[model samples]
Target: MLIHGVALMALAVAALLAAFSSIQKAGWLAAASVAPVLAVAGVLAAWAAAIHLTGGEKFDDHPWV
Candidate 1:
């Protein structure tokens, strides 16, 4: 998870740099847009991992019989 965060941050920085160099507004917008999604995905992954490590289940088990 830490590695993923670091990678995402690095990519975000790279994207920012690329955005700065590009002439098209869409290029800058496209580069800026991916960072937040990556960040959010990383956070959600860590959260889900923590829950799994703590023995929490994503769904409740109910006996039907």
Candidate 2:
């Protein structure tokens, strides 16, 4: 779970950078690629929030300590 969250964050960062790059060098179609990236980021963020709100331990049923 820990690794999953970190990986998601990394993906989001990569997506953001790609989106910025596309916008700088391409046009509307390239910019459209960013929508999926943003969606992934949103989903990951929501997942993280759900885990936090439900008590972090619930993520994979393991206690921090």
TM-score leader: 2
lDDT (CA) per prediction: 0.55, 0.64
- The reply for model 2, stretches above 4 Å from the true place, is 27-65
Off by over 4 Å in 1: 1-30, 57-65
lDDT per residue for candidate 2 within 1-65, as digits (tens), equals 66666665566566666666766777768678775676567567656755655546534555765
**C-alpha lDDT (0 to 100) for residue 14 of candidate 1:** 56
TM-score of each: 0.41, 0.47
Please provide, for model 1 over 1-65, each residue's C-alpha lDDT reduced to its tens digit, 9 standing for 90 to 100: 55555555565555545445442545656657655565556565556555545555566678783
Each model's total of backbone clashes: 0, 0
How many Å off is the CA of 56 in candidate 1? 0.8
Q: Poorest 10 consecutive residues of model 2 by lDDT?
A: 52-61
